[model samples]
Target: MQFVKERQDAPAGFFEVEAAGLRWLAVPGGVPAVQPLDVSPTRIVLPRLTLARPTPEAAEQFGRRLAITHAAGAEYFGQPPAGWTDDGYIGNARLPHPRQPIESWAAFYAKYRLEPYVREAYDAGVFDDSARQLFDRVCGRLADDAPEPPSRLHGDLWSGNVLWTVDGAHLIDPAAHGGHRETDLAMLSLFGLPHLDRVLAAYDEVLPLADGWEGRVGLHQLHPLLVHVVLFGGSYVGRAVGVAARYG
Candidate 1:
């Protein structure tokens, strides 16, 4: 069986980049990615996946495997996936995937992740001047923070992207790139996941998270919230502002 996704009006390179992202995120002995069969500008064909209720055991295994996937490690922040050499998309928004490495995660994130969507939301009138200033303050704090090496990230790891099956979780619809691993984890938390506590615990056991990582969850969450504010304005504005206020 095959799953075919078609979007005739998709932006240029949409399905092509999605296929590239899935291929890039495929790591041996790691959580499985839904295999792409064929791709074109407007459509992608993938192996069919069956949905199942998530189990705690599967969640734990997914965590450990996800740690291995991140361990595959990218050369630098904002690096595009191996096959594709251009920016990608997250949901409906363009995601920055730069060729040049930015060694500083903070700088790369501030520039590529936060600033673009923030400015877009501000221009859309979803964000007021105060909200913009709050994100600015957060960026300043990031500048001073110690940086970690870039990880091969799933980039858009929201729970909906994880398809549970009899075998376990298979990742689909990635915005994969070289980025801070915490961003992926934070995204998982953005929308609730099944057995989330077990997932985080198992991941920590495989690769211990940084100290104060709990405190920094909101910081990592800012990007997605900002994206949401741009993509779907409404209560998302307040949600993004509240999270930014914590770090700002």
Candidate 2:
């Protein structure tokens, strides 16, 4: 495949490369700023790396570092030239139409982040009336006073997204945005991968979670669960309904 690289002066040695119809770039130093870019036609291929279960201490330390990085807030890298979707769903609602400003995290999540997915699921019959009602309740609660300030987010984070390289652990395949830091941590917890205690301990060391974080886990998870409900049907419907129940 033909690959073109555009150079940038960032510390990580960033570059924008195009192959096929998709556009992706590499951040030279180990850490991946966003999920490895996977345009459409050309796919991103990386070397094989070993991933072992991190020790409690190592996991905690790594988790702390991730928290610090997430706290770095968002970047306005100009407007996207086009729109795309994941699997079959749109990447995110188009920005700057009626409500795309980054005024507050809660508003962003409510409109652009969670609501779109919720509406999709509702339209697809993935969510029953009760489930939809509960979801609205949780969103309202979160909107009241979100736990943390808007921080840069790795939209879709899971164990698979964390690459353990020779240099250190790196995050890849990010659906990057500016939202809550806990959203990432909540994702780590939701999937049951990545050592839980260690990850939280590490995050606390760097940026301690606010009180009542435990209660908000359901709120943060609703978005992902809704996505799953849309993508995987019955399997996620129960889980999504359960989470919605918490706020209702």
- Name the lDDT value of residue 98 in candidate 1: 67
Best by lDDT: 1
TM-score: which candidate is best? 1
Model 1 lDDT at residue 248: 88
Q: Cα deviation in Å at residue 224, candidate 2?
A: 0.4
lDDT of 1 by residue, 103-193 (tens): 5888888899999998998888888899988888888878625467889999899999999999999999999899889989999999989
| Per-residue lDDT of 13 in model 2 | 12
Give per-residue lDDT, candidate 2, residue 108. Answer: 60
Number of backbone collisions per candidate, in order?
A: 0, 6
My TM-score estimates for the predictions, one after another, are: 0.97, 0.73
**36 in model 2: Cα distance from truth in Å?**
5.4
